[model samples]
Target: MVSLAPYVLKRPWLTKMLTPAANWYASASGYRQLGLRYDDLLEEENEAVQIALKRLSAKEAYERVYRIRRSVQCSYTHKLLPKDQWTKPEEDVPYLRSILAQVEAELAEKDALDSMTVIKKH
Candidate 1:
């Protein structure tokens, strides 16, 4: 999906104005309350995401798995984590996004190369 995120993020005033609404929306989305960072909720079925996940540092991968498992357990129990245990706003940084972007770029570049036509000049 195309997003205005980059555009809005580039403008200081827009970002400042939107930050609270974004935070509220995130909190209201309930994943953080379940102790899952936003990245933890990304769809793993995606090829780019799968590659990005594999590229994560061991510690980050472990932590991501732990968070997912903990969230799953919470889901079974029908309970949210205690407030202190909930993912904090700062802690909800997009750790996977950068890697995912890099993987996507690589895939696009590979596709471009694959589609290239080699023309012999006489």
Candidate 2:
């Protein structure tokens, strides 16, 4: 709930100052080299993430599975994907983020409704 992300993102100067460092960290993380997007590395044990995964389009779901499988294969072999096959910076998008956000929002709404305290002001 408490994060500096929104504050930094809202300020153009702060975002500009951090963009290069963020990019550098992403590049250094090696998931791109394994052909996996940042979202692909998310923990599936989460309830909201499970809901989000179920909501993915069939094509997107297939690609997600393929990427995970390929990354697992690479891990087993102790090798990265070929340079050409490595995920480009532009291709490393957060495909699951929006869906996950939606799912989390819905869950939060459900919890609020379930715990509602209706006051009778007779």
The whole-model lDDT of each prediction reads 0.95, 0.95
- Candidate 1 lDDT by residue in tens digits, 1-122: 99999999899999999999999999999999988999998899999999999999999999999999999999999988999999999899999999999999999999999999999999
- Candidate 2 colliding pairs: none
Model 2 per-residue lDDT at 31: 94
The true-versus-predicted C-alpha distance at residue 108 of model 2, in Å, is 0.6
RMSD of each candidate? Answer: 1.1, 1.6
**lDDT for predicted candidate 1 compared with the true structure:** 0.95
lDDT of 2 by residue, 1-122 (tens): 69899999999999999999999999899999999999998999999999999999999999999999999999999999999999998998888999999999999999999999999998
Candidate 2 achieves a global lDDT of 0.95
After superposing candidate 1 on the true structure, give the runs of residues whose Cα lies further than 4 Å from its correct spot: none
Measured by TM-score, how close is model 2 to the native structure? 0.91
Off by over 4 Å in 2: 118-122
User: Which residue pairs collide in model 1, if any?
Assistant: none
